[model samples]
Target: MGVTLFHHVGGILVVFSLFQIFFTPHCDAGNILVYPLDGSHWINMKILLEELHTRGHNITIIRASSSWYIPEKSPLYTSITVEMGKDVKDFFDEFIQEQLKVQREGLSLIAFFKLTKKFMSFLHVGHTLWCDTAARIFENPKLLKSLMDSQYNLVLTDPGIGPGVVIAKYLKLPLVLNVRWITSGEGHFVLAPSPLSYIPVIPGPGLTDKMNFIQRIRNIFSYSIILFQQNFVLAPIYNAMCDKYIEGGCDIVSLLQDADIWLFRSDFVFEFPRPTMPNVVYIGGFQCKPAQPLPANLEEFVKSAGEHGVIIMTLGTLVNALPEEIVEEIAHVFAEMPQKVIWKHRGKRPSTLGNNTLIVDWMPQKDLLGHPQIKVFVAHGGTNGVQEAICYGVPVLGIPLFFDQYDNLLRLQERGAAKIIQLHEVSGHTFQRGIKDVLHNDSYRHNMQRLSHLHKDQPVPPMDQATFWVEYVMRHKGAPHLRTEAYRMPWYSYYCLDVLFFLMTVVTMLLFSVFAIFRCLFCKKTKTKCKQN
Candidate 1:
């Protein structure tokens, strides 16, 4: 009886031990390597990395020396910086200059298209240079061998960098894309569903899910243009980089198709309704938080304004400085406003600077936007800034310059949360009136607050959702089951274009055959009639 009792206790102990061994943490102290292309990408990635680090995952970041922010070396996170031999920040500055030049000249209908084509070409060149510079890191034999042996659980890539896909493939690691932009330029079709019928290919032309006949035609044309550029232009640039850096050619399309997960910096609140696959996750306001206390000077400034409130103006990191005349015109407008203004000016202070307005090279944008006295936010309409405004329930007066800024602002306008003044259209009266309208109107505030509530009222915080999914992908070893079957289907078959063509071809053949037979019978009958005659 004693032996039987002891045996039963031993069996229970063994079962408990096995359970503990098999069911530990989902992540299992896994190593995660992240490649954030630039400051913009890094800003979106920063909060996600913090969450992952706190969760006991080993985090490694490969940063460019020109990266705006570099986290300190610690046990939780480490970084490897690649010297690009040029200030990458200059790229943004140059791009902005070109945009300002065009805005100044007022783009002609033909010149606008030509300018767009030129800018896209220039962007490709920059991407090539970026990828080539990044490839230098892999040239180090020891580092490459160490990374290969480490067997990282996941490779978090910013698809903005063309070479990131190739590097992940070379390491033989599972790929998870961190796309920071709303625009789907970077081979995203592989993992996400881009039904062009309803989805606006670009930002404007008054498009929504319920598009009119003309709008649908415009959507198709926009998608066709984008597809042509991606396939004919972007694909070759990426493929060339792959051949130079990777052993087995990592095609961009193939890499995206094999990606385990995609964390988009977007949300349903901002985007029109569109189809999404299992592997795609939206964490739009993941990095955003409620306003923090302002600095003493800024606090006092807002306090002094009293009932008048304050306005915040910024063009984000990319365009820290604006054209001189535009700044002067803005300064003049701010001088006349009843509210106190805080302008983030990187260039020389405008001579029209007012006592009511303060000029700074940088400002705590999110915190300022969250302030109660803050009435309006005049910005360039970057996704992060727009989302931050939405998070804080701040009404925007957008002065969109380029890229998706125009589209982002257009969407905000559609939602009645913002007003837009194009770069070329920014005059003293226009800028001032735009600000006055948003501040005076109750509708903008109401819509923004509603969207803010919707954005915040989520089943789980976006940060946790992102972290859980990242770990989930790692735990499951690539999460192949989560990927959509669409990736496996060819482009022709995916859209059913091939099937439609085949059916059409068969019907045409049958009709022709019938016509031929009818003609033959008619000829025979005519001959018979002639013979009878």
Candidate 2:
């Protein structure tokens, strides 16, 4: 009996030891490699990473050698540079080759070849690369091999496509897709604009803007042909090269499909009609940290405006090339306004300036938004700027340029938080009216404040949600269960409702035929009985 009891005690000890070994926290800290393309992208990424570091997550940023713009000093995060093989010269060379091929062949193959060549032109053979810099880390057999051998649990990526998604998919690692802007998915519930919303107008917006019924019909066909060329021909050509070089066997949409979860930097207040994907989460207005104090000069500038306050104008990063006529019109609008204007003019300043108008090459956007005296934001409706305005509960007068700016402005307009003025149609009258409407209207402010409350009253802040999801991926050893099985189904199977309807029609027809046959047989029997009588 003593020997048996001793054996039982030994067995329990063995079981406990095995459990400890299997469930022990091997990854106390996770290694997060970020790949943000440029300045704006880096700043957005920095906000999220800073929050994660604060919460005890290990973070690393890998960027291109030329991308030297640092928005913030992050001592906790380490930065590495991946060298590029070729520079701008190689890009031009590839462009020329592709153009020449297209001229010669007039076919889709040339377009695809040129895209691949252009991608290669930018990178140094084996040392440097394009697409997302994160791919380099994965392709670095040494780094990836070590991580695979070790116990790092998760890899968080951004823009949801390109190198970042490819690395996560190839490693069979769990990933969170940080969709900062609009992706190919037309119906994502993020603050980002849909690409379909920006389809260019033919004969431009000038003539087509006021087209009659016949003209509208003709324009639709023309637009369809252009769209067909762009989507079927041009886009596919570009995507094929992206698949070959950047993604290593996968395409952009396929990468998005493979992600464990999607984190959107937007709120439902804007009302983007998105499909109900179980893994997608809307966490907009994430950059709601307290603002840093404004500079003394900037503070003075606002105070000098007195009761009227200021109207801040900026045409975001990409569309800095404002036509001289538009600049003149903007100058005229400011001249007539009751409020002082602070314009972020990236190019040459206009010769005529009103006493109330202040033109600066660049302004501290967030700091300016936080100011109590600043009443209106005259913006290009970029997702970042739009969210910042909402976070601060400030009204916006949007000048939509390209891409998702139109949709972004429309969403804001629908919510009564802002108004939109198309870039092509901007004039002194329209500009002034838009400014007055947004600044004077009490409703815009009320709506903005309501949204601000909703944005702030989350179970966790946006950054915290980002951190929780990141760590959750690490803890679960790649959240395989969250991945959608949509890819496994064929295109035909996915549109299965159509297939079901087709089958139902066939079954109904067969049943009707059988009923008719039985009725005919009964009638023949009745006729034969009548003949016998």
Candidate 3:
């Protein structure tokens, strides 16, 4: 009876301790806010925020006034402006000035080294500092001060913009890094587009032939340099500044060491060397939300395409500036096709027009895909567009231009949900054949539908996962336990080659000693026998 009583007491204490550790001080769920630097990001943020709001969590969104590439006239502009507060612009201006000061100083080596070491330690942490040109403009000390004072549970930031990550660290807030593309070592999983979608590969006669070997080499080297700057240099420096300036004394990785959860939008189908973090959650197909209602005229226009159906064409926001010659080739291909084409041209239309082809400067993409008459989508394979197509259960013909587009299309191809055509090889025949194959092929549609169902059938949508994790951090007073011990291990030690060599040497010595002893014993025995004889 005494022993049993003691055991019961111990059990109660253990339970109480666990509660004190995880639920102490009672986390304020209302103090959660999301920062998506630009308007395009609002789409995904909106889905997650709406779900969270419905669940009775207070959420605030900081919206950027404009993006570098996307103009104010774009549909994305209006979407952001609708719910945007004034905080984003104010924050961005301050962020830019601070960044420029650091850059002018050429980044302090001491700070850089210190931050890099910290990053190396917790390399497995899902937190990443994104450094893109546009993001630099959005960092604001005053906004950070407000958030810090508010005691917000956590800050979720997009990768490619260093300022957000830096500010989160500065404010000593827990952060979740959102990787939108296949960027450096930051992404737990990278979303890449198809190789055929690249500008160099997009089908065109004599495209590669025009460039000499030296020019091609120069281009490849130039791309590598740009990647290096973004990944190795800028990312680390930005992180250091956040640590030194924002957190007062703590570095970026130390700030990140408090965070372990990452919400990735990439599937294995897109990125190679799939990154693993202690708490990374893959949520690639999350963008596959239900299609929005179509405009009356747009719905009618798609319905007019009939049994053969229509093909949708879009080059995405970044690379819509295609040369006239390539546009002409695309135009010619559409003219030859028996299937009607709905082309989303960002710029002026080509002179070559066909009765079957309807060229518009822009079209409501999700609505068009939802239309019954739409059969296939030809796209630049941007992450957002790909997810939308998958959600709508539409097959794609990926024409990747650059960056993660190759990786994104590769994912689609691996899933048998899309076909990839090289941009340089884009000819009338190739375009026609590729379109026909996707339109006529039963397998493409079947694979897309199957994946779409799997994507949609998740117990909670990606937005839910995103929201839950965010809330979980709040509820737990920050999920610090998820942070990895990678920071403790040096780069060389993480690889374990040093330990491996040490073990190998010890084993080799032991074997050699044994062999020598055996040889010595045998020799002694032989000498004894000879002497005895």
lDDT tens readout by residue for model 1, 9-55: 99999999999778855567789988776666777777778778887
Report the number of the highest-TM-score candidate: 1
List ranges where model 2 is wrong by over 4 Å: 1-27, 68-76, 84-151, 180-251, 273-275, 497-502, 505-509, 512-516, 519-533
Query: Which model is ahead, 1 or 2, in terms of lDDT?
Result: 1
Q: Give each model a TM-score.
A: 0.87, 0.73, 0.68
Candidate 2 lDDT, 249-325, residue by residue in tens: 55555566666777777777654543456666776767667777878888888899899999898977544447676
Off by over 4 Å in 1: 1-25, 71-76, 182-190, 203-207, 210-218, 244-248, 501-533
Candidate 3 CA-lDDT value: 0.61
Between prediction 2 and prediction 3, the one with superior lDDT is 2
- Candidate 2 at residue 59, lDDT? 69
CA displacement after TM-score superposition, residue 337 of candidate 2 (Å): 3.3
The 0-to-1 C-alpha lDDT of every candidate, in the order given, reads 0.80, 0.65, 0.61
lDDT of 3 by residue, 351-435 (tens): 7768888877778887788777778999988778888888778999987664456556766787798999866666678877888
